[model samples]
Target: MTVKNGRRWSTANAYLRPAMKRPNLTVVTHALVHKVLLEGKTAAGIRYERKGNVQEVRAKREVILCAGSVGSPHLLQLSGIGSKAVLEEAGIDLQHELPGVGENLQDHLEFYFQFKCKQPITLNGKLNWFSKGLIGARWLLDRKGLGATNHFESCGFIRSKAGVEWPDLQYHFLPAAMRYDGRSAFDGHGFQVHIGHNKPKSRGWIRAKSASPSDNPEIQFNYLEHEADREGFRDCVRLTREIINQPAFDPFRGDEIQPGNGVVTDAEIDAFVRSAVESAYHPSCSCRMGSDDLAVVDPETRVRGIARLRVVDSSIFPTIPNGNLNSPTIMVAEKAADIIRGKGALSPSDAVVGMDENWLERQRSGSPERVAM
Candidate 1:
């Protein structure tokens, strides 16, 4: 069988959409999984809610949590696999004291530097009514056009400086005029380079702010706390400036719009970055897997103190990957499906895994390599 998977869309669009027609798989969208029903420490089923009523559904073999980082941790906490104090207060029996269940949270912190292009090479200048109509026509006829732009058309993959060897920094070049603010402030003739950390040392956390599933979980991304992270961030900013000044982007050159051209000092950059940077929306590692006491799950993605429940999402990453996390998250799910089906999974990184520091050093030197994880 041949399957064509698009690059950027979520699994719901690619896999579940067509698979829903199959009788073996049932698609439940509106249902909210409230908790994992346990039978003698084994996850036998799930308690879910629909409309105003609650119900339970059994999993004959396993309950894989495909919930994203935040959702998965909340599910674990609700299922009594999180902090002991939090679980007890929520009236959940303490099944585990896995402090790491909602810890080790890492996210790509993004800083956008806006600029005005000299010419109209930026996407902002091209988004007129006619352009929109043409692009829409192309998309309707074939699944291609401006609609297919996932941004970051041109990217810079490098270390912060020449001495470093691993790729610790990444730059996403956007051809359009975008804003850190919402779509309203969008000017039609601007360009931006979104600078981000490949391996942010400043870790934060995910916590169930409220018991209600509708309520968003509190995400504390304590970014730029570590000295190394701050230094790395400064290097990333300098690198971004250097890349923008290169001949490849000369035609798109505009006045420095953010922190402006005058903000050159490291101290100024640090202050500006802290105030301006926001989430890359790549939250992960809240339910880290390891052999340590704090680890919420084991190497196999199974809950440390429970059985038959596996977290197959980004949460199980012991250490968050060094790039945009969606691809890595899908790989985790793929490997997990094998484990759940009694098929042996591949441990690609275990045989020749290097430490984070080595990778960071490599990034600092200029060659930001994609290491297997």
Candidate 2:
């Protein structure tokens, strides 16, 4: 299988770039899937458009959707496998009635506070041409400078209190400020720490705003709706402030730049969080896994009541993972491949790294490999 990162890692770089010489895999680009073509009740192929022309790509054995959360649900709805009401409203014929096709959307909410560092230990201080050139030179020579940073510098998972069974909170440390540049938000600037409730009890939804596949769906997340969640986030922020105030960080301290030095009370912090928080862009649970008919996919990831079709992506995560979804998404694909090839599901840890018993034991003991500030 292709290996780079995950879906965000281009298939060209991960799979095609290395395997162009292989004769078995056919690679196509700029092809947009419009719908799944069914032969009676089983998927026979897919309808796609390219260069303004619609065509079909038939699979001899099966069809799988590797599209991310948004694209995956959109494809399902477009293929007449969504709620009957939505399909009729969009003037599309219904093939399947999976009412939960686009429900249960959840994502990590991130809020950040920027500070003007008194010293030059931050990325914001180096945006100038001179420092940037030096940094580029170092990366060019050694492949290990500022370029090696992956935005989130450190990570940790914690349960809110002692009795909780699973870690509910996640933290990410950053060495720069963050910005929202329209298409998506980004983090940059002075050292900052991001704290989020990893397993939010709250849920949201994604729905088709219109019939056209070109139309982007609406994303409505009711974040921070639970009282316990509010308290947890408040604690996370306060803990971050405490970390910044620690003596180990004194040399890089700077004036508070966001929610500033004046914000201390829970109410003020709540207001700041509501206005400033944005998506960590890790949406999931729209098509959850379960035994109930309301569930979108069965435990094997086969769409309920659908034949010869499967969804192999984040959409099937009954609950979102404790950290970045890239790892889990890859694991799902790997296991799915084995299942499809008649080899059956691989042993838990054999296919996925994080599912190891040792890892779970570490998490259970509250002895995570690392803890973010």
Candidate 3:
């Protein structure tokens, strides 16, 4: 597959055309949520700012917070529903104190193992304006050509090393190399393995700077805070090198442009990871689901102390999923919709998820590095 298509099909403004035609669902623009209006301890409605005017929307049945991980916690804190100390510092009268509101922030962080391509088969040549326009025209005329897919065809779900119980590493192979933000890092044809540990022991948190709703909240993804996480990165680098160096890629593989030849030592790899690693833009679990003390929402997605309030987003994910947040968020939204409609949930799918019992041993079978460790 090639990434001839633009990113995030549902995010573009044009995707809202169908939603805009919905009579019951009113889409508001240029509005910032100021607060969740609460009568005593019950969530009544919401207040927002639009065109310098404060507007209120009353909820007839429930108030669902779908602001996502970062925005959900930020809005919760803005509505005086977070840690007691944080609300006190922000001078907002605490409505409901959920200490875990912004805790347990998790994300899928990745590092690119980029290799320069020996040939011009990659997307580097088609990135210019002329090629882009022709590709776009071809796509607009018929949903085909290089503009159809993300060009991310192959992927691997493997264990990082021996002794792991399951597949803890995820790899996404791209036929072109570039920065995560789409900037070309090298002016040549190349490929990249977007690889990272599926499960990270490191945790982070989000906090509101003040009670102001428009102010951006503080976000910290304390990545690679655990020794195991660092070790996982080391394994990711090594395993990617092993794959790219195989005979299959010998025709296209040129040189390792990312951690290069000098980054062999464990310390060197760790340093490189620390400097180059980036979030896969998949943040979740800031407001986790559970009945535990650290949980911000119950299994039903309701805020503990606030009546008629629910959180329906990835923010309530107990842990980040192994993949991107889009699909999981869709699942969450679907479930929440059923709940909102008062429909009985369908029977469990009972889809069996199996993994090798000796995943770790299997991972390290031919890899001598983990044996020495």
TM-score, candidate number 2:
0.83
Q: In model 1, which range of ten residues has the least summed lDDT?
A: 364-373
> Taking the tens digit of each residue's C-alpha lDDT, what string does model 1 give over 1-373?
1123323557776667888889999877788888888777889999998887898899988888878788899888777778877666556677667778788998888788777888856677556789878877876777576666566667766766544555678778777667655364356578887887778788888876555666666678788888888888788677677667777667777787776887789899898888888888888888888898888878788888788888888888877787888788778877777877779756556577444465533433223352221
Over the stretch 1-373, how does candidate 2's per-residue lDDT look in tens digits?
A: 1223222355446656788788987777898878788876688889988899999989888888878788887788888888888778777778889898888777787777666566656666666679879987877776666754555657676655445566677777767765533232223336666677777878777777666677777777778887776777776677667657777777777777776878789998888888888788898888888887668888788888889888988988887788778778777877777877768654555464333244433434423343431
Q: Between the candidate structures 2 and 3, which one is better when assessed by TM-score?
A: 3
Cα-lDDT of candidate 2: 0.74
Ranking by lDDT: 3, 1, 2
Instruction: Single out the weakest 10-residue window by summed lDDT for candidate 2.
Output: 1-10
**What lDDT score belongs to each candidate, Candidate 1 first?**
0.75, 0.74, 0.85
RMSD of each: 4.8, 5.1, 3.4
Count of clashing residue pairs in every prediction: 13, 5, 11
Candidate 3 C-alpha lDDT tens digits along 251-342: 99998899898999999999999999988889999999998888898888899889999999999999888777887887898888888788
Which of candidates 2 and 3 is the stronger one according to lDDT? 3
- Candidate No. with top TM-score: 3
